[model samples]
Target chain A: MNDVITLAHGAGGRQTAELIDRVFKAHFSNPQFTGDDAAVLSIGGADLAFTTDGFIVSPPDFPGGDIGKLSICGTVNDLSCMGARPLYLSCAFVIEEGFPLAKVEKYAASMARTAAEAGVRIVAGDTKVAGKGQVDHLFITTTGIGQCLAGVHTSGTLARPGDVVIVSGDVGRHGCTILLARNQFGIDADVTSDCAPLWGTVEAMLGQTKDIHVIRDATRGGVGTVLYEIASQSHVGIHLDSQSVPVHPSVRGVCGMLGLEPLYLACEGRLVIVAPECEAPAILDVLHRQPYSQDAAVIGQVTAEQPGRVILRTEIGAETMLPPPGGELLPRIC
Target chain B: MNDVITLAHGAGGRQTAELIDRVFKAHFSNPQFTGDDAAVLSIGGADLAFTTDGFIVSPPDFPGGDIGKLSICGTVNDLSCMGARPLYLSCAFVIEEGFPLAKVEKYAASMARTAAEAGVRIVAGDTKVAGKGQVDHLFITTTGIGQCLAGVHTSGTLARPGDVVIVSGDVGRHGCTILLARNQFGIDADVTSDCAPLWGTVEAMLGQTKDIHVIRDATRGGVGTVLYEIASQSHVGIHLDSQSVPVHPSVRGVCGMLGLEPLYLACEGRLVIVAPECEAPAILDVLHRQPYSQDAAVIGQVTAEQPGRVILRTEIGAETMLPPPGGELLPRIC
Candidate 1:
């Protein structure tokens, strides 16, 4: 490992995994330590899921959400991915000195509203101030506690051959929105962050069936990254039908202009779910009835052939291997 | 509140309270929202304590500990303050892009070691990297979940008129150490931080008696701030015997030279405990036997004379009110 950390170390891809393996995992290796979205804890004879996420999105506010809402949604979705019902969340903020107090209140209000919508309580918080240039405008780290539903289990390692893969909604909206929010490219396009709490969506799916294999939010590295993670974890291949993948028109246009692969752009509200082939339609039926998952579509399937690879069958029917995610593409795009 | 946040707003004193009241409390007002160290949660038919704290201590490494050890100790102590046995912890790190990987590893090792001592598992974690100047070296926020003891209930508001106040050890070491670490005054002192996980100390005390009224760790604003908070919350007066208050010789020398109040300096490993007068000796006995609290002493008693006030009685028997803490004294002390 390099002596100094780089942007790629936090990119939520291979480099991030390597850092975790070499540093965090080596020291914090315990029976309950998690490589999954959340840790499944057995407290007082009941299963609970615990997770934390640090949000450092630049611009603080984008089209659909700000860091506060993103902070809450990020952790809520993490617990939801573990088949848990979000219960209580604790937020810790490190605000740069001289940041507007009204803006902080605005973020808090957004957090409260988002927590209310997700059926989670914002119970505990800590605030600290850093000197003007010591930190960015603000950063919020949210940790969540969730109760695992009975007989429900989901993990990245659970992906299996013949399982259908579904995405909860359109991809790349959040990353594209943040990219445009930076305004470095000067590209004019309509894009909104797909940032929302996914507990309700997960709950609805679990209510329909408990046979889900894998559930992961496509956050930092988006759908492509999550697929690679699942493939590596489950030792299975993923075959994507590129034409069947849902993408917002604005996001598609932005990606096309930038020559960026939409598949690797981040999404805060979407989920990549793997379940039995027979239960895919049933799960999609439940997801379609939900507001956040109305665009739910089966974009791929788990395969026994070519383990640890993601093969995309393009719209023109030509098959090609999707390159694995590596170095940082967009820093602080969480 | 001012239009923009100032350093005093995060000082953990009067201004910090105002910010919490005007912004966070106003927006996140809920039955479960906390004004104490940690929130008592009832999940899955079990009582659990949940809390979060962000550590941005400058010069990340210090005499007795670094940011990593402080991070674990902070959240573990918060849960311990709630009379909860520390169980699971989740840490989120926001690191600057160019931080040294070796330093990060050192911090992580310290965290792992401290969590092991506290009997807590680092079950989940998240890491994000900001641009070179967007953040300081690194900031760590740890959230913990602990199973609340069956019959023990401790809060800042539970102190009674006849309760006795105990200082778990010599105070002001942590804050003084930080002050000296900054080297702004060019004065050298042999002081080290009192940063340690206090679950063992609390566990030993609970083993002695569950009648303890309150247990608070003096962190940012120190023992004086904690005492004032308890006085205000319980609506009772605190009478301190100034001569009986324990202070290490080096800490006292530093404070004497700097005209700083030892009572107002932070002590990371110390506790300001309140309990019935009859239980004081037993509690002190247990604390004294423990390595961390060998200097435990009964320095004061709760009184009904002046609610929401702390009176210090000198050796000559003259009583004076301890000035309430306000504004910023030391930034990033914790």
Candidate 2:
């Protein structure tokens, strides 16, 4: 590992994982500490899922959602990925001193709205103001606890050969939006983040079926990175029908102009799901009817060949390997 | 309300309370949300306590403890105050890019040790690295879920006239330590932080009896602020025997030199306990036997004479009202 921290360490890519493995996981590993979006624990004769996420998005706000909205959606989606019903959330904020009170109030109100939309209550919170320049604008860390829906089970390790790979909606919009918000490339497009609370989307899909094997929100790292992680965890190959993957036109344009791969860009409101091929039809049927997943589609499938790898097929017939997720995408993009 | 945040907003004093009320409370209030150390919720037929705290202590490492240890203690102590058995904790970190990897690892080790001593599992965690110059070295936010101790109920609102007020140990060591660490005063004192996880202390005391009415840790604004909060919550008066209060000789000497009130300085390892006078002897006995609270002493008693206020009886028997907690004492003092 490198001796000093870097932007890549917070990019939610391979470097982040390496750092976590070398530092936190070395000491914090225990019976209930799973590297999944949330850890599922048996509490009071019931299964509960708990997770936490830190949001330090640069600019704090963008089209579609602000940092406060993103903070709530991020954690809620983690629980939902575990097939849990988002229940309660606790937030801790470290605000830069002299930050506008109106901005703080605006963020708080946004949090309340987002929590309500996700069917979760903001039950506890703490705020601390750091001296100006000690911290950038503001940061919010949210922790969520949810009830695991009965009879529903999902894990990254559950992907298997013959399982269908489904994405809930168009991918990479969130990343593209943040990239342009930075205006580092002197490019502007009408791209908005695909940031939204996704518990309802997951709940509505699970209502129609329970045989799903894996469900993970594609966040910090995009759908491509998530699929790579799932492949390694489940020891299966992922075969992507590249043309079937969906991407918003504006996002595609932004990525094209910047020579960025949309597949590797972040997606705040999308899910990479693996389930029995037979159940794919039903899952797609339900997802298409939901607001957030209307563009849901089967973009790939799990394969027995080339274990722990992802292969992308061209629209014509050529086959190529998708490079492993690595390096920093965009710091504080979430 | 100020147009911009001041250090006082994070001082955990009157200004902090006002900010919480005007901003957070206005939007985040819900049935399960109380302005206590932690919020109590009924989950899966079992009562639970949930809390979140952010640690942004400057000089990350103080005389007696580091940010990692302080973070764990803060949340653990919060749950302990709610009469809950600390169970699971989720931590989120925001580190400055280029921060030393060894320091991060050391802090993680400290967190592990503290969590082990508190008998809580570090079940979930997240890490983010902000660009250099955007954040001071590092900040950590920990959220905890604890199983409420059966038959034990403690709240600031439960204090009644005639209840005894107890100090678990000598106060002000933590604040004094941080203040000296800043090296602003140039007055060197052999003082160390009283930072420690107090679940075991609270557990032992509760095990002795569940008759305890209120329990609170003296953190940012110290014992004085806590007493005032409890007085306002319970609509009662606290009359202190100033001479009976225990302050470490070193801390007292430093405060005496600085014209600072020991009662207004923070103590991370102490608790301000309230209970029926009949149970004071037993509580004091248990507290004394515990390593963390060997200096436990009865410092005051609840009174009906001055509701929503704290009075101090001087050694010469002259009584004066303790000033309300206000202003920013020491920023980033944890």
Candidate 3:
């Protein structure tokens, strides 16, 4: 609705949704188009998922990973969220005129390692350079193709009452890491980004049961945003036992000092999963054995009442509605 | 290699190839990785082609096309070069914080129109915003997946001795258009960009024959760079009847005035097609009937005598080698 684009339009929130609806979806409407992480396509008897993401993180390097690692994780997680195994990736880079070639090599090395770890091939790519001041240091846009797992269907709209909600790992570490990396708040906290590829974690969960209800990555706007999205899309209420939500100690310290909600901070490697409560034990059992998801736990459940709302039960037993996810939280966190 | 990235590294010439080899290919190499327009992928029972291109053409708008249209055309043409029918496209945009929403909408509309013409669906997309002054308005990256034609095969390494080289249309218009749009040289010319979605042109040629040896779009370093690439890849020399290379009058005028070689300029809508001399008639016939290639003409022939070289026979019947392609031609000209 704004005449000019704002940072909120890229914040993965309500404004981002509106822009997609009014501009992109309005013009690019078609049968196979998807608002989910990836578009599912039936090609030559194979079900496939295709997705793309652009990374413009302010500080290219963070505590746990650089832009290259983050870029691969972002797209791989998107495919994983669709119950798809990422197979191929294409990377396109736009480098500013005077950026260091060694840094480029470093990023490429990181990407190669990440892609190998994810069992995905880097098949095609393009590179362009903009004159100095015309672009930031570097930006990467990665597109991934994946094979959708048979007998498994996961979508934000599939959440149902009585389904248990699971967090794959500690929340808000990535957002907290980025904030600290920028040093805008003059805070020194020993927080590292949760920026790992999640295909293995998702695979572990699906190995237990293919009857998962919804699976979504908490990337730009974090677990709180992901929950709000699933709740609205599935028309189910999310009731969170807020005290049970996992938060790393340093991240909790940073959030407490900054007066920020840990739930609303970004998590590059975390997943907000909803599945039948009966299957939660098996899913959690497998997740607990996984590398990136050792902190997996059931922190909430889908509710029949208060549809489209997220209610949090505090430690003192007071209940409050989680703020609807919107506005500019932080730009370029991923 | 330069310690820092230079404009030449992204100019799609020798320096660009060096960067790709020393950095990207060294790390990302795999059986499916490609140096061609698109990577040939076998999925299930169908052969597929996947490609990605980044468009950072400065000014965003030009005479005949905007960045949005150019993005679609670039990806579509890349897939078409592989004799593939482009099916699905994923677009990602990186926008500056305060770019006009209307411009974004306009570009989206242009992309929709071009994708419709190319018979491809825009299925998925992501948007990220950089802080103001951190980016040059916006950059778009489009990734396309296409079904490879059943009986056709094309590659830069497939050119053979005695094959004829053909230009799909007038050369250098896109480059000329961008040069004028920038107003770097104060020349008033009527050149419009040759930027177009060219799947139809390739389709028409394939319908006539499936034995096309190689197809390449002339962007960045233009026909000269593409020719040089093919010459070395296929270990063949190209002998050009220089006068026969088609150049629109306005474009010719601009190049003549600027002392720039039209052969080294970009053509977004043109194709540098190589095929057996015997197959030239049918390929040229169909190209002539196509909208994008109406002015298609035979420009040269491949020879085994001088491998890895390109010789030009001028109008006065003197032979000279065309300069090898390298260095910065024009930055961010798509």
Candidate 2 achieves a global lDDT of: 0.93
Regions of candidate 3 where Cα sits further than 4 Å from its true position: none
**For model 2 chain B, where is the 10-residue window of minimal lDDT?**
B25-34
What is the C-alpha local distance difference test score of each model?
A: 0.94, 0.93, 0.94
Listed in order, each prediction's TM-score against the native is 0.99, 0.99, 0.99
Q: Residue by residue across B281-331, what tens digits does model 3's lDDT show?
A: 899999999998999999999999899999999999999999999889988
Writing each residue's lDDT as its tens digit, candidate 1 over A226-319 gives: 9999999999999999999999998898899899999999999999999999998899999999999999999999999999999999989999
Query: Across residues A1-334, which tens digit of lDDT does each residue of candidate 3 receive?
Result: 8999999999999999999999999999999999999999988888999999999887999999999999999999999999999999999999999999999999999999999999999999999989999888999999999999999988999999999999998999999999999989999989889999899889988888999989999998899999999999999999999988999999999999999999999999999999999999999999999999999999999999999999999999999999998899989898
What tens digits encode model 2's per-residue C-alpha lDDT throughout A1-334? 7899999999888999999999999999899987999998887887899999999999898999999999999999999999999999999999999999999999999999999899899999999999989989999999999999999979999999999999999999999998889989999799889999999889988999999999999998799989999999999999999999999988889888889989999999999999999999999999999899999999999999999999999989899999888887878897
The candidate scoring highest on DockQ is 3
lDDT tens digits by residue: candidate 1, B275-327: 99999989989999998999999999999989999999998999999999987
Error of 2 at B303 (Å): 0.5
